[model samples]
Target chain A: MPEVADPEPLPVPLARAGDPAAWDALFRRYQLPLYVFVFELVRDESASLDLVQETFLAAVKHLGTLRDNAKFGSWLFGIAHQKCRQRWRQRTEVLFDEIPESAGEWEPGPDDLLIRREEEAGFMNLVAQLPPPQRAALLLHYVEEFSLEEIARITEAQLGTVKSRLHYAKRALRKLLEAKNENPA
Target chain B: MKTPRELLLARHRAAEPKLDALRREVVAAELNNQATREQSFKVSLVTSLLCCSNKLWRELVWPCRRTWAALAAVWVVLALVHLAQRDGSPPALAQSAPTAGMILTFRDQQEILNELFADRSVPAEVVRPGIYAPKPRTETVALLAA
Candidate 1:
């Protein structure tokens, strides 16, 4: 058999200067992860959606300022973080709305579904208690599967700061879970 | 003894948000809206600027350039006349002594008015009493009675 070179990865669809389809593709690809990341930080489903929308709107207005198209995911998240902060500043109280029933039906074995739901609720509660930066760092690091450097880039923080936030967030979450287990009420 | 981070990660995989139909729909709609808005706004802005510049050059600048230039020239001539008047010789010095004497008489009348106003002991009644009346009605009645 003859040896063959590996094909290159497909180029990311950047929202071109005025290409609506390209922008749509980029948004479809990253919106979920970006929304989840913002949701983890703010802990409110509706507010997270609003933040995501505002972030995209801002990105559209200022897309010319972005230097690297390849780093669009991180850039979008950065804008989302700024919008999240603005929302927080404007309204200090945070409200965590239950996930909409429209989020669709879950089909799993009964035990598995129950366990998963409990875990998700517990994890979300823990995440909600974390400070904004630490929560963002943890979500990007673990949930979004971004590396330390990527988290730093997205959060516009130093690499060490990102690492420290993740470390502390994990420790805090562990302690919280342990406390919950001990109480069991 | 504590569990490692990787172990915790494995245990929590199911807790993540699933790619459900509704979620997908919401994401698609939001993305579509964003892309459309961005594209439309950019196109509109470019079109508006182009239209504005074209109208300015064709309807405004070109049509008004001659009028603007003529008005500018008139303004320059008026400015030069004022400047010349300021820098030219004193007309007072060029006048005959009789004309200068008339100017001195005008100055004397002004001086008399100033002195009359300034003199505290001179009853206001002696020098244009009606002129200094506090009320118009009193002066009017006095004039009518007179």
Candidate 2:
């Protein structure tokens, strides 16, 4: 039998300090994840895009100051979190009635797209109803796949505070989802 | 009951924004916008250099009060010199005046001889021939002609 070589791992995408192309490459690699993260945080497409753009612009400007290039994902999300906080502070109401109709319109691949979308939408709606800290914690913990420590770093909260928020957020979200399911709204 | 956190994140990844088209459009537009802004900034800078206010130019060119004062003094001196020459008047003060020896020797020879006699201790060296002979008039006439 012929020996098979293991495939080379794809290089982790990292923006060179101040290189726009590198920033763009990083943007391309993480845009979707960051966008979804922003969308989940802000719950509006236009605001999410604006926040993402601001985050990227801020990142590009301050890229040289970043100590670790490998942690670009968490760094970007941290910027996104700051932007979200600023926006939330400026506007008393974070929830928008105008959810993107196109969000529901996106077709899923071979995976159960509709079911996942429904679940996501339901989860977001439930999350939206929670207090801001809890919501942020839940979104960072679950949707963004940030570890508890990463969530703390992103949110600028202590580890215990983040854990508390997550605990309460999960309990709140479960109650909301269960209530919705029972009512069949 | 299934935890909402696990279920939400799993579904969230499924709906993640695919970056193919959006990335290209956003990045291209951003880069183009930056280039345009830089070009506009350069144009504005050049325009300001060429057509900036006279006060601004004065401030830039002179930069300091001492320099401006020096420049003013030079200009005033030049202007006075020019006016004097234009009006055909002699300079107020000649920079090179005749020395005392030239004037006294020419105008008051008796007094000069008296002063020399009072100060002198005569020696054999005073008897050197042609020590005080008048120069030949040829060189004098040539210089006067020039």
Candidate 3:
């Protein structure tokens, strides 16, 4: 099947002014990436969907406060992060790093392209193991292509803190991968 | 298979799970939201005045577009500053009666007033020399009211 070309993200002014076409463009541009980010934070697909919805709605409501158009992606991610926190507050169980030991068989579907490499799945599992802040910083750094400053703004952490989260997260992931390989469990 | 940029975006799109129905649901909800916002946009008097002022300033006063915008922004900042200062200034300093001197709390003020009025029998001069002169009941009370 041929892939359709994605449209550019709507400019901030349009979304801030409540344009539906702009909103649709924004939703299409960020939905997949946001789902991935939120899903890593909270492992349930249904919960991720709700969180995504809540995040978008909150973004819409508070769009006026956003001063810079370039930072919309970080702003949206920040809202999703807040939603994840809200969900964590509501729930009692802790399952941030608990993927099944055996890899699940991939059903023939669209999302296969993201995990096309086997190690991509391994990478994601290790990602799940890191603490929430570190995982967020790493994902924002690598997956979302955000700068340290952008990550700091999104996570509401000091620049030094964001830098450390990325550094520590990478170190911890490296250790986990090495341990996994040595043992081959 | 378009440009390299398009290909990259396509890969990102591929990360999206099969959720055509969900996407439809979200889009429909946004359209509904737009409709509701459109319907709810009955401009209040203040909003109309603001819109009209903005238009008038842009069109006539300093029609150089950018200049007028800057001027309007400065004007708004000045107005807001004036309003904030007006609101935050100590009004009680000017408005409080001299006779109600140095009373802190409402309960304390009430107690002092009770003590003063309870001894209504005291000749008005005793309270303050010449300040509270010997006077009929109505005159004394009237002076206190003032």
Candidate 4:
């Protein structure tokens, strides 16, 4: 399997050293993907844009604290994830049940479930309906192509919790797809 | 049929141009934020350093102000005394050492004083050790006779 690369190899070292061009390059590379992820989670364009800007600002300020420069993408995603969580907390008090961070039974991963082009809109709508944590996990795992470990780090959840979320999220998506197929409106 | 990744990408295709516009805004905003943060950090650093120096003065210097003043006064007095002693020292004499004629004159004065103070009755010949002539006192002769 080919290792998934971050859109491009960012000049993290120069950016960390406070280079303006390097910072611009880093933000340019990640802006779209970061905006997409934030927009999907928050569903507000202005808020998402603000969060993206906030995330980049934070990345510029604290880039020195990031130990591994190679994991800059996941690290940036982690920042945006925290921003979304903060926004969610401010907007509503939605409580999530405790998810057991234990090894779950075998299940079909998102990769195994083929999504047809026609079902894209319906699938995204279903995805939006998932619980915030599950949606974040699914988006990070499938859409952003982050590994389970990366998703766990980005979400600040246990590795087992990440796996459980991915498992349940894909299951819920499949059910929604089936239901939509049966009631072809 | 497409993978979920491709489908999601397709779903977001419409937003790319908007994202492109937002990119310039985000970059500009981040640059401004970074500037503000750096400025705040510099200000905080200066404030902390000033606070630290003040604390040091209060803890280490203010408590011993009297002792330090007394020590400074003693040093001042010592410096003044040293300067006064340096200035008050006697000047060197201008005259050279005494000549041989001065030494001969001193010896002649000493001889004349010894002669003037000698007994006139005891002549030089009578005062010789081998020709000793005894001049007895009357009281001594009477006692000897008795």
Off by over 4 Å in 1: A1-14, A93-118, A176-185, B1-146
DockQ of 1: 0.01
> lDDT for each of the candidates?
0.63, 0.64, 0.68, 0.79
User: What is the DockQ for all candidates, taken in turn?
Assistant: 0.01, 0.11, 0.08, 0.28
- For model 2 chain A, where is the 10-residue window of minimal lDDT? A99-108
TM-score of each: 0.47, 0.50, 0.52, 0.62
lDDT of 4 by residue, A1-185 (tens): 12235545779888776667787787767776777788889998789878987897788778888999988989999999999988988898664435343555325443676766667788889888888888888888766688888998998987778878887888788897788688878
Model 3, runs deviating above 4 Å:
A1-9, A93-118, A176-185, B1-20, B40-146
Calculate model 4's interface RMSD in Å: 2.7
| Candidate ranking (lDDT, best to worst) | 4, 3, 2, 1
DockQ pick, better of 1 and 3:
3
Candidate 3 CAPRI level: incorrect
iRMSD for each candidate structure, in the order shown: 10.0, 8.1, 7.2, 2.7
TM-score, candidate number 1: 0.47
Q: Residue pairs in steric clash, candidate 4?
A: none
Displacement of the residue B54 alpha carbon in candidate 1, Å:
12
RMSD of each: 17.7, 19.3, 23.9, 18.5
Best by DockQ: 4
Candidate No. with top TM-score: 4
Clashing residue pairs, candidate 1? none
Model 2 chain B: worst 10 consecutive residues (lDDT sum): B1-10
The TM-score of the first chain in every model comes to 0.71, 0.71, 0.75, 0.86
Query: What is the DockQ of the complex in model 3?
Result: 0.08
